[model samples]
Target: MTEAVSRRTPGTPCWVSLIVHGLSATQDFYGALFGWEFKPGPEQLGPYVRGRLQGEEIAGIGQLPPDRHLPIAWTTYLATDDADATAETIRSCGGTVAVGPLDAGPAGRLAIASDPNGAVFGIWQAARHAGTHLWGAPGTPVWNELITRETSSVAKFYQAVFGYEAQAVVSADFDYQTLHLDGRPVAALHGVGHALPRDRGPHWMTYFEVEDTDVAAARVVELGGHILQPPREGTSGRLATVSDPEGAAFTIVRSGER
Candidate 1:
C-alpha cells in the first residue's frame, strides 16, 4: 500500500467523487473492482461514504438526491484556500458555480462549477478532512485530466481561476497542454476537437491506478460495469475506459509509483 499524505496546495487535483443513484450497488461494484472499504462521512449533504484501502482514504461515494435528476459522473475537485473566492473567480473567468461554497459540516467547504465548455469540476477548501489521503497504489486515483473541444480558451480559464502555468504540447496532431503548479504537473487538458463524447460532454476524467489494466477491465465487466474502451497501450502504460453500472465513466491505468 502506498503511504498517505495531505494535498493542500491550492489548484492541485485533490479529490474525486461520485454521486450515484444506487449507493449500495455502486459500492458493491467498486468494492469488487478496487477492494475499497466504505466509511460513513459527513451527512450534511446526504448518504455519503469515503472509500478506503487498508484504512487509507482514496475517494468518496455519495447518494444522489431523489428529487433532482443530474448526470452520473465523477467530479475532479481542485484544492483551494477559500472556496468562495474560487467560486467568484470561476464566475469572472466565464465559468459557472452551480453548487455551494457551503459547509459540509466542518469537514470542508465545497462548490461545484463548470468550465466555459461545460466541463464540471469542484473546488474544495479543506478544514478537518483533507482531500485524498493515499497515492501511488492500486485503487487510488493517480491523475485527473480535462477533455474538451478546445484547449486555448479553457486553458486560460483554468489559469486565471487556479493560477496554473499552462504549457502547451508542440505537436501537429495532438492539441494538448499540461497545467503546472509550483513547477509540478498537476493536471492536463486535451483538445479532442469534434471527437469529444456527445453523451458525456466535455468533462474532467478521473484516473484510478490498477495493478493490471486488462484484469481490472475484466473485473469491472464481471461486476456489472461496462468497458467503454478496451485496454490499450497508453503513453504512460496500459489503460482502459470503463463506466460503472449507472454509466459514470472513469479510466483505469496500470501506471503509477508502485
Candidate 2:
C-alpha cells in the first residue's frame, strides 16, 4: 500500500532542490556548504534561490538552460494534496511529465516528473509552503534515493506512482530495497548494476543533513566544491559526494544511524 496521498508529511524530508547549469555558482556553493540563506526569486523564475536553515524555509535553487541538456542535479519533492491528481498518477505510472501542473504563487502546486527508471521528481501542493520545515535537523533534507538502472521497472514505477511498498531487507552485508509509504520508510531504490558510472543517468539522489561528513568534505573542498564521493561509512550515516560551484550534484549525510 504505497499510494496513500493525503499530503503534508513535511517532516522527514520536506525539501531538497537543485537544477543548475550555473546560477552564479549556486549561491556561493550552497552558501558555503549549508549555512544557506538566499532570497531573491522570480525573474520569470530563472535564478531562483530559497534555502534557509535556522531561519526556516529550507530548499530550492534554480537556473537551467545551458541548452537544457539537464544534469547537474539534486531533486526530491513529495508533499502532495493533489498536483493535478498527482499529474494523473504520474501519467498512469509509466511516468514522464517534466514540468508543472503549474502555479507557484502561494508557493504551491508544482510538478516536474520522471520516474519509470528515469528518476527526477517533484510534486508539492502545499499552498503556503509546508515543506522542508527543517528536516532531520542539521542542514536539513536527510535522505531520498532512487539511483536507478531499471531496478525492477524502477520498483514498478514507484509502486504505481507513490503508494510505495517494496521491502526486501537482507542482512549480513547489505542487500537493499526499501520504499514503504503507509508502512513508513520512504525511499531507496539503488541498483546501478556495476556501481554507477557508465556515464551516469537514472537519477534521483538527494541527501543533505550534514553535521560532519568529514567536515562536509572539507567544506566541499573549500567552497569551489567538487568532492564526488569521499567520506564513507554507510548502514545509514556518514556519506559524501558533492559538486556545486555551478555543477549541481548532491549527497551528504551525517544523520544518526538508521
Candidate 3:
C-alpha cells in the first residue's frame, strides 16, 4: 500500500469551478438546483461566478472560449503545491496538457489536463484561494470518480502523477477500484466495460452532497435541469444523476457519512 499525500497543504480544497459554454443559463440553473448564490467576476474571466452552497464557497462556473469546440462540462481541480511541476509530471505520465499553469489572480494558478484514458482534471496552486471551502455538506461537492474504458492505463497514469494507490473492491453488483491518498480513499475508478453504459465517454464526474435526494431531484427538474437518474439507494448513500440546462452531467449524493 502506497501512502499518498496531496500536493496541497492542510485545510486546502477551498473551492472548485467548471468552465461551460453558456454562463447565465448555467449560473441560473445550478443556482436554483443547489440553492446557490453567484457573484460575478471580470470579463476576461468570461462570465465567471463563484458558487455558494448555504452561503459558503463550494464551487464556481464560467464560460469557455467560443472556438474551443469543447462541450459544456465540469472539471475537478485538485489542490497542488506548484501547477508547473504538476503539469510536467502529468506529461511524463502519459497525460496531455490542455491548458497552462496560468495565473488566476486571487484564485491561484491552474492547468487543465487529461489522463491517459482521456479523463480530464485540473491542478491548482492556491496563492490566495484554496479549493471547495465547503465540501461533504448539503448542496456541496462530496466525491469524484473517473469512469474510463482504459482502466489500467488510467490507473497507472494517475498513480505515477499523484502517487495514488489503486485498491480493487469486488461485489456482486459491480467491481470498482478506489484511489487512495495517504491510505485514505479520495476518488474512485470504474471500468467502462461493466460498470457504465456503452455510450459513456471517459470523464470525471463530480458528486454534490445534498440533504435529500428526492427533493434535489425534484428541484433539478423544476429548475429546467434534467434528472437522468432518479433517486436510488446505494452502498454509499442515496445517489442521483442529473444534467444542467446546457447538458453538463453530474451526480448528487445525500449522505451524512463520508
- Identify the candidate with maximal TM-score: 1
TM-score of 1: 0.97
lDDT of 2 by residue, 1-258 (tens): 112223565212356678777676777777777788777653445678787766777788887776777667777887767888878888887888878788877667778888765667787777766666666776777678777653666787677666677886665444468887767887777775666655557777788778889998888888877887798987787888877676567788886653
> How do the residues 84-134 of candidate 1 rate in per-residue lDDT, one tens digit apiece?
999999999899999998999988999999999999999999988888888
Question: How much lDDT does each candidate structure score?
Answer: 0.91, 0.72, 0.75
lDDT of 3 by residue, 58-89 (tens): 78798877887676678888767878998999
lDDT of 1: 0.91
Ranking by lDDT: 1, 3, 2
User: Scored by Cα lDDT, where does model 3 land?
Assistant: 0.75
Worst 10 residues of 2 by lDDT: 1-10
Scored against the true structure, residue 72 in model 1 reaches a CA lDDT of 96
Candidate 3: residue 237 Cα off by (Å)? 0.7
* Worst window of 10 by summed lDDT in candidate 3: 2-11
